[model samples]
Target chain A: MAVPATRHDHPPSRRAAESARRAAGRSLRLGFLLACAIFFGLPVTWLLLAATKTQTSIFSDHPLSVGSFGNIAQGWSNLLTFNDGELVGWIWNSLYYAGSSVVIAVFLSVPAGYALAKYDFAGRKALLVLTLIGMIIPTAALVLPLYLQMNALGLLGTPASVILPLAFYPFAVYLCYVYCTTSLPDSLLEAARVDGASEATLFFRIVLPLSKPVIGMIFFFSFVHAWTNFFLPFVMLSDDRTFNLQVGLMMLLQSTDAINAEGGFSALPIHQPEAALAALVAVAPVLVAFVFAQRYLTASDVSGAEKG
Target chain B: MTDTETAGRRPARADRQGRRPASGAESTVEPPSKRRRRLAPYFFVAPYALFLVGFGIAPALYGLYTSLFTDSLGAGTEFAPLGNWGEVLTDYRLVDSARNVATYVALWLPSMLMLIFAIALVLHARPGRFAAAMRFVYYIPGAITGSAAALLWLFMVSPQVSPFSPLLDLLGVENATEAVSANTPLILALMGIAIHAGGWILIVYAALAALPRDVLEAAVIDGASSWQVAMRVKLPMVSRYAALILIATFAAGTQVFVEPTVLATGVPGQISSTWSINQLAYYYATQQGDFGKAAALSLALLLVGLVVALLVIYRTKFYRIDRGLS
Candidate 1:
């Protein structure tokens, strides 16, 4: 509770002490807020400026200084001409990979999470444990194994190589399990069941609609996971044509004229500002998605869902 | 899935304190011949189970098997059972990578928690449009992909183009590489990680939001200082959420790849390049063409991540059937 400023009875010294303490706390908070603004706000803002700067100005200009719209245009055009619009293709590939994986994960994870949470089945604990294990395992650990498997199946470098591995989002499944168990009242499902609704019908018609927010939340996360992923696609696809934005960015970074080990710029097409532009390109969709999902994913999204 | 079976059963689980106590929620009576009910769950679980087999279990098994064979990165595998694992255990780069990661966790795991915790506390301390707007601004970067964020931070850390260049220059930072020096890339990479702190601030804020209004008011009436309320009352009240963030964030640190990889991209030698475990594994898988070693290193990271997560789960009883971990 906010303290009322009525110090009607306090001694003058004590009142001064209380006000001093209150003022100190206020400054401490303000200081923290300012620190946060710098820590959190500085880099993205810098990147925004970097995106607008000309390639040469990237080295010459002050880091945070505003640049021309011409620089933004040039950065983009440079990115386009780099390997003949290769970065744009990577952007498309990332959308496809992330989009498809989200689709598969949402459809499958919801049902599976429902099953694990709602049903009392043999081996359910084992299933939960399996999901937990899968959920906790690092993506790095899975890359080599999946690479070998894909290679064995002769699917390496294909879209499936990345999409399939990314599709198994045990974390989302666990989230769904938690959602269904904690938030979805068993009564709602039972009512559907009592009405002679088939399991498929109940899930498709009832559970799916009821769980739209969680689904959106899951889709948003799954898309982020796939879209931002570097290692899986790094190992799975060798072809430059199939690369996601992260991998493509890496490739561009390596070839960027700014970072070339030798003195003068290399014959490589990509450069510092163009790479920055490509990076912005990759992050654009995610920003859009976050905007759309912001309402669905308020602080109370998972935990607060139950309150509603 | 068995959305049908437990469609109405909270029996033993209905009493925990949360948004809704399970006690009053109507649970369905189990029909007889629920013996057949066991089979129903398998149907719902099949999709996840299938994916687990294809993507999780199978790949992990294959990784283990691959780790037993050296030079498997190439077309041919030369079976040297445990040879790669031995190398992984004794490699100098492994030690360096571990130290780098440990240093990073020490820096990152805490800073991430504390920084976000502080913001979370501040925002929760005052609820208004300003806090909400700040929360939105903070989380917008959460949507920025890791590599993109890294690239963005690369700009900030780069003294040449950074807006904070004057401040960084005043601190003796001459270039991005110097900013994320070989010895201490932790700070540089953290900026990239910190940009995503907005969502977590909201998360911790939400956890704080769950604190009962009367309890806080009672503390205030007791003449508890604002600092005491924050430290003694609010902090303890939200410790569970803080712990969750702590454990999850630490687990995530083990997988830190993009920031380091992107920052170290054309740097000569192992300055910031070989500073993380994933980088080591990535070098093996991609550069060195040693899938066996990569697989071994990946397993090491996986083991560490899993252990941390499991420890948190155990400590928090997050998986307890009743009294769901907030």
Candidate 2:
């Protein structure tokens, strides 16, 4: 009875107008969201679907058909058997390089950034300026110089060549600086000092423990940068055994670089399906890290990366 | 009075005060002695600082030195200042590389921002699990490495075995080359880049999240339509975040590499051998063994990168963290 009374309390025309407005807003929102899903989400969907199908089935009349999971297994097998289990070596190398770099950067860059943020030191401003420039400058600029360095030291064929340059993570240092300056409290440090705690004691016991989130963020960022690094490793590491996944991936892509004179492509370097699987392999670590780290990688983390 | 103790040494303040550590004590615990407080920072930073100098500053200076000399076939390293720079600047491959990158930035910057902005706004409007899941999905492609994304998109563009071959054919594209042809509505090269560029979408969504709820409700209560509120209020509020993403994108965009190189496979002469400026430098250094030329080109790119960064630092002023352009 109350609902009926309330329904009639407002004029019918006005109620209808309000309902129309609400409906319009809802549609606008959902429609744009649907477009977003199709735009951003569709390619991945197409990729997964295409991966499940046999290469021949892809172009049949029903290209989007639900193909069997067996195809993925087959693709996996093919990738393994190609060139005497080569991709495994490359994947291992990528993990080693990216992992080692992340460890070094997390340990080193975190402290460097902390020093910049918490301590008033001479040359800090100069270091900060250098970091900013290092970040903005493209990775391409460093590859040539590093190659010469590696060449001059006679370390070109070794993993150390790539590992050394990756350690110079200026961007991660800056990220840590921004995170600390904003989130960390100077009062706590001064209080610790007043309590007669040494700087090392204060840092290890208090500051390092509180800086976990930023460290995680820096680890993942550095990991991704090193993992996807193609130019440096490409220039420095020529041995197949020393190649990271990105360089190996480039090598795989190169096999297909030549186009046919008859207006078509030759057989893909690897089967098309296998290439997708390799791509999946290449990105799985990043995706896993994201799933775990997204808990800590908030908007501020991105802002630090973008605006730091 | 004198600088006697090493900088690494800290003052044993706890022992001097004769104070307990507020807890259990260990005999092995030695108090720190400090002489130079300011120098203590260098201790905190020395590990990474070594990297900064050995890998960063030293190599950069070394690059400049390398750029000044040429090592050619049958000739030892000869001093020829600006020689390599002069050659590479006039090289058509370098010219085309720069042109292609400029064209790509022009195409990529606007569409990328608009796509990301729209998606962010829509997700902002609907605050729910669905939006969150969609954001996660959007970020997945970005996690994929550049070479992998290129391969994935290549499969999509390949007319021989792609699910979207029909749609591509409808667009009159018969093959991967045509699908990515500069004239095509959907450029495959840009598509590879756009997919990898989805990381910014989350940043924008977060910006939108910071919009005050009460402000929006007030706009609605004041007789403003939903459309008007979004257009006027939300748009303006998030424009700063959008601008930050744009400037960063512009700086990164000029260094485009992996996307063009990987996708250029399907297209023959339609794309150049050295499709990107980075790849051109790589080719000069590694393939041609012209380290001087590569270094020269890299320095040039570095100058441009610096200029772009300066534009953002000075022009945008968004770095003033306290104010936040709001």
- Runs of candidate 2 exceeding 4 Å displacement: A1-23, A114-121, A151-155, A177-214, A250-270, A298-308, B1-44, B73-75, B121-128, B159-170, B182-189, B203-247, B317-326
Best by DockQ: 1
Instruction: Looking at model 1 chain A, report the run of 10 residues with the lowest lDDT sum.
Output: A298-307
Docking tier of model 2: it is: acceptable
Q: What is the C-alpha lDDT profile of model 1 across A1-308, one tens digit per residue? A: 44435634687898799789889988888787877777667766776777787767777877777889787887777677668878779888999999999899887788898787777667878887677667766666687677778899999989998898888998678666655654555555554555666667877877776666567667777888888888788888888988988888766765555444452344654566666666667778877776565555433332233334
For candidate 2, please provide the TM-score of chain A on its own.
0.80
**Best-fitting candidate, scored by lDDT:** 1
TM-scores, all candidates, are: 0.79, 0.77
Clashing pairs in 2: B9-B33, B10-B32, B10-B33, B10-B34, B11-B33, B11-B34
Tens-digit per-residue lDDT, A1-308, candidate 2: 12334324678898899789889878887887776666566667766776686766755636456788998888777666656778899999999888887888888898888888777667877777677666656565566667777889998878888887887788778666655654554545555666777788877987776666666667777888888787778788778777899888666655543122333343543555666677788888987776665555333332222221
Residue B91 error, candidate 1, Å: 1.9
Q: Give, for candidate 2 chain B, the lowest lDDT window spanning 10 residues.
A: B1-10
- Give the per-residue lDDT of model 2 (tens digit) for B236-289: 765545544655577667777666665665454566658778779878876887
